[model samples]
Target: MEMVERYIYAVTQRLPQGQRIDIAEELRGLIEDMLEERNDGRPVENTDIERVLIELGSPAELAEEYRGTSRFLVGPDLFPAYLSVMKMVLIITVSAMGIIFAVETILTPMSILHHFVDLLISLFVTATQVFAWITAGFAAAQYFGVAPPGLSGGYNRKNWNPSELPPVPDKKKQIKRGDVLTGIIFSILLLVLVRFSNHLFGVLLFEDHHLEATIPFLNEEKLLELMPLIYLMVAIGIVKEISKLMAGRWTKNLAIANLVINGAIFLLAMFILRDQAILNPDFVQQLSDSWGISKQQEEYTTIKTVWKLSYNLALAAFVITLLIDTVTGFYKAFRK
Candidate 1:
């Protein structure tokens, strides 16, 4: 019956993936037996199925029985995504902070050591704020009855209809685990690389086969000042990918989400690269000098022109990547 299938879908959606199949089979058999006993092998009707379902109780109650417990905050439907998201955020945040700390210390060992306590405090404080915000967001989403498809979401759902059941996704539409994981890793790496570009990419000279002097290619203070904007971009990317992972499939909604996130990222990139001070003048001159060229030389002038256009170059790169990603995401999401 349609109602029986709806009830089964509801109950099974709230259960673990591994248990869903067995529980669905068990529920189907029990319902069949109940219907048989009720009508004495007479033609089954929606009325009979309704009565059986009523006896079995609401899907939530039945699922609670199966789970052997009740958990509303971060319930079964949201827990897996919640856990994976939390782990991803925490790991990336911690690793990024560690990279910054290492880079700062290498740049100025004594200075960083003097502010060691401050740095540690900042890391903990940032981590704590991130944790609280993520937990609160999930909690709010649950209370507000918002959730990904194929989930019970919240108690605000007054009815479970057979029509509400999600169709099994086709293989072409299914988002792969490797793809999601790789996207996340690449994003995290980019955030770190950009955040510490000044220290990571610098002019280096050696004397007697020993490292002698170095000049940072980018303006450290300027990049630090724009950290919040960079972080905002990273945050949007994380949300986009997390949604993809949860959806586990492509849809028009996913395509639209990808578009919005990509647009936002491009805007953020424009804002960040708008500041020309991000490149240090001293680094450019020093690099030119190392090549035995002065500012008046044609070669040095050409180098300066190229260096001054770093903003355009970086923005162009971002635009290209964003275009590719947006196009691919839309194509797959809307593929017939």
Candidate 2:
């Protein structure tokens, strides 16, 4: 009986100070009652106490039951918030993964379907972690009794009085010129940083002619080879910057314009490259030798499938980005 009392005290010690003594006393009384009924007026022993405790259940589970109907980790009220954040995060992550898969399919000679499956798995794992972290923070806050700072204090309930509510602000007062200008400047700086890093790497490591000819379109001897890529990059960057500065129908229009410009450049490059048969002779011979196709048939069928896929991928990327930008623009416009 003494051993049982000590064990109960030890288990209940970690509970809040206000809850500890009452829970401990109740548990002690229940154990005593159980022992009394079991012994039939005989002396109680340690084994009897142990058997009773075991039948009652684990101390941790008992503590959890006692602490039930209270907010700790994710309570019923906050589950929606947890699920909403998780859903939004997963959507964003999948979209980003799709963009990544498109780029990888374009640049690499790997199987597109296989890479896409791998990307989906990777995105799911990443989204799980992100959602876990978000929910964990909320759980931690509820456990610690610390409400998130700067959010509404009162719950939205039925019979809530309008007089008790704070005055609503004018919608027109929300727009700030300085805030918009700051966002535009920050966005431009980020784009500039990316461009600068790419240019630096291009000049230093990729300047050599030996590495240049390995890529189909980057060969120096190929006239106007890089014009398409340059035009596409510049057009996309400008459209992104314009969208940030002024969102609405105009932003969607700009995105469409960028996509059209990039598509045109890609088509022009394909026409020129195909006419010159840049990937014809050597690529055909390699394919025939590897696949056991006859040499005469190789010339007719062996095309630069990888290079063509890359061009198509670039066009696809622009279209996808445009679609995302257009949707986001309309969402923000309405949200404002």
Candidate 3:
């Protein structure tokens, strides 16, 4: 029957590839036998097949039973915890990646169409990687019989302690996952951009619907020199974001971690910005030429000076913003 075939397909699809054909055949035979018994030796029809399948239950459940393992990628005992953690990781990862992408698009001048295409590809790849890794981590934990932290003895009443319960989190003081995710994404993208600026940071010019020129803005040597510190900062940022996501609200520990990360970032930013040779000379020359500054000697010097000043000012503004955020977090975390 068509229903029989469809039902068999559903069950077999959940099974291992090698087992599908044999399992499907066996399941079909059982269904036919059951239908014959139900129909009193009459021919089985699609409705009979449907009735048989309904009595047997869902395909996934039947497949699992046939496999002789009650366990899933995540067992029932750990499912609640798994779900929570999975949601947090997914939200953080997606949010962070999105923020980084937006920042990259804004900071780096590029063709809108090209940037959108690049972003779509990057997001798809990154999202898939993040989801697979997070799911695998949880699945491995489930398989290993590892319990989620703070869920002692699997939600037993014996472990309850009213006195040990944390104070009610202030709703206004909640640490938003979206915000934390954005920060994490920003840090990660910054790390990647800084680490691979030579390849990624370039200006493309088009003329008559054809690419005319390309110019890179960063010196590879200088960027490479800052990789270690940049990596450290990025790692710290990721850790902080994860902590914030887990806590779900501002707390002293998270606030302190945020402060430390911000401080470290500020120091690194200062160090990186102080390098006079960090900017690619050729890029500057090209930019100057494009601005038509080379033709006016007096204007060239003044404009160059203004550009350098603006660069320092931008860095300063970033540091100041970090300081403000750190202070606000500290105050909110510690104050009544």
Off by over 4 Å in 2: 1-41, 45-71, 111-114, 117-121, 144-336
User: Between 1 and 2, whose lDDT is larger?
Assistant: 1
Q: What lDDT would each prediction earn against the true structure?
A: 0.78, 0.55, 0.73
Best by TM-score: 3
Instruction: Give a tens-digit lDDT track for model 2, residues 1-336.
Output: 677877697659656789998888888888899999999999988899889988988776777677674435776656665665566456545655665565455434347888978897998798788878988887876677564421223344456666656335334323233443444344344333333322221222233322221222323334335445544554555454444333323334544554564456456555655554432335444434545677456343534455457657865785676567456544544453
Please write out the lDDT profile of model 3 over residues 1-336, one tens digit for every residue: 887788788888877799988988898889878988999978777777778889999988898888887757876666776677667666666665565666556545466567778778877887788778867887887778665554322343457667666567687788886787677767767766665566456665667655455565677787677678768777877787777766777888878888887788777767766756677766656766866768468877775677678667877788788889998888878777
Q: What clash pairs does model 2 have?
A: none
TM-score of each: 0.56, 0.39, 0.62
User: lDDT tens digits, residues 1-336, model 1?
Assistant: 888889999999999899999999999999999999999979998888999999999999999899996667767667776776787777667766666676666656668765577668888898899889988888877777577544444223556666665667789888886677667766777776676576556665656664456667767888788888888888788778878977778888888888998998888877776655666757668888888888788988787777768746766777898999889888898778
Residue 88, model 2: Cα distance from true site in angstroms:
1.0
TM-score between candidate 3 and the true structure: 0.62
Ranking by TM-score: 3, 1, 2
Task: Give all candidate RMSDs, comma-separated.
Answer: 14.0, 14.2, 7.8
Clashes, model 3: 1
